[model samples]
Target: MTKLDDIDRAIVIATQGGLPLVADPYGAVADALGLSAEVVIARLDAMQQDGVVRRIGVVPNHYALGYRFNGMTVWDVADDHVEEAGRRLCATGVVSHCYQRPRLLPDWPYNIFAMIHARDEAAATALVERLATALGPLARGHRVLFSTRILKKTGLRLGRQQGGGTPCSG
Candidate 1:
């Protein structure tokens, strides 16, 4: 794994909310980091190449974007094919996130979770069907839980917080 120092990690945390909308976003980040714009850009490029950072893009609120109907489709896939099937699901544009998670005994044990978003519940359901069909019999069982509300959606902060970095007014 590519090791990131404190400065690099700080950069990552600061930019996670989304790059500045201004003409020179990198420059803004550089200003915040007290480094030259060129250095910030170069470091970000290197971080991408090293797999430390995925694509730096906006994470829009799906509901605001007209994708009010979003669901978490959990699947009980065969252990052997879970990885491949999850990858296939992730490859689809409709799948916002796809990963293999552990099952929780009696109540829930679906190993696969894919975030499916659409304009409506019907569309989201249809997309789930398509994904199941693509997986064929590998997808033995599945369930779709549409999100009725967004309790929290925020970027993660790495490193230790001194409790005085950014003040919250409200």
Candidate 2:
């Protein structure tokens, strides 16, 4: 594992929620940290290369973007073909997230899960059909579990070091 220095920790905390929405986001963070914009950008790049930061990308709010209808499409695909089926579905540009989870036997048999966002129920259904057709016979059965409410989403957070003040604290 890579160790984070004080400045790196501060950078992580400052932008963990998200980068400032401004023309120069890195500059904004640098200003808050009493550092230069170039330093902040370089540090973030190093952290990303070191795998400390998985990714820094915009996370759109589907509901606010007029995609009110979204569903978690689960499929009961053969264990031997789940990986290939998932790759095919992902290639269709309709799957946001795809994963293979263990089945619960008689209760739940879905092993492959993919997320789809749409403007309405019809669109959601169409997306499901598109994914199913992409999988062809590999899709033994499937289910569309629609989301009912919005949940807060955030990136990983690091707690204050023991016996030490937080990196963001002066």
Candidate 3:
């Protein structure tokens, strides 16, 4: 396994949950680490280059935000057309994630799935309509599974930090 130096580990520890929703999140992390922002950036950039940091992406809590209504729109697109369909759907800024997965022939026939978030049910439906128009004939049929509740919401932390997560409770 690749070892993380003290500084890199500190950076990961500070950001495991998320970066502060502030004007300068990197600066906040740097201050916490007692390192300059430039150095923090440089170290993170290096880690990313070396593949230590697999991905650095935003993790927005839509439910906590005004976008309380979320819809998992799944589509049954032609096997040959799903690729083009995914590319088109991705261009539709309303979509947060668009990807294909296996379909159960009997009960579940949908293969493509996209996540859309909105303030209410109607807005979420409207976005689904836009998605249908964007997907065109690539999609044979689709359904929007409206999220009724958020059972659990958390992120997958990589490796143990100085002061890490809690023990699982049965």
Number of colliding residue pairs in each model? 1, 0, 0
Q: For candidate 1, write residues 45-116 as lDDT tens digits.
A: 889989878777767788888998899999998889988898788777678888889888888869999988
Sort by lDDT, top down from the best: 2, 3, 1
Candidate 2, residue 61: how far the Cα is off, in Å: 0.7
Clashing residue pairs, candidate 2?
none
Q: Candidate 2 on 1-170: residue-level lDDT in tens? A: 67788899889889998999999999999999999999999999999999989999999999999999889999999999988998999999988899999999999999999999999989999999999999999999999999999889985688756333433533
Measured with C-alpha atoms, the lDDT of residue 139 in candidate 3 is: 77
Query: Roughly what TM-score does model 2 have, to 2 decimal places?
Result: 0.91
Candidate models: Cα lDDT each: 0.82, 0.91, 0.85
Model 3 residue 61 CA deviation in Å: 2.5
- Higher-scoring candidate on TM-score, 2 or 3: 2
User: lDDT of model 2 at residue 144?
Assistant: 92
TM-score of each prediction: 0.76, 0.91, 0.81
Question: Which number leads on lDDT?
Answer: 2
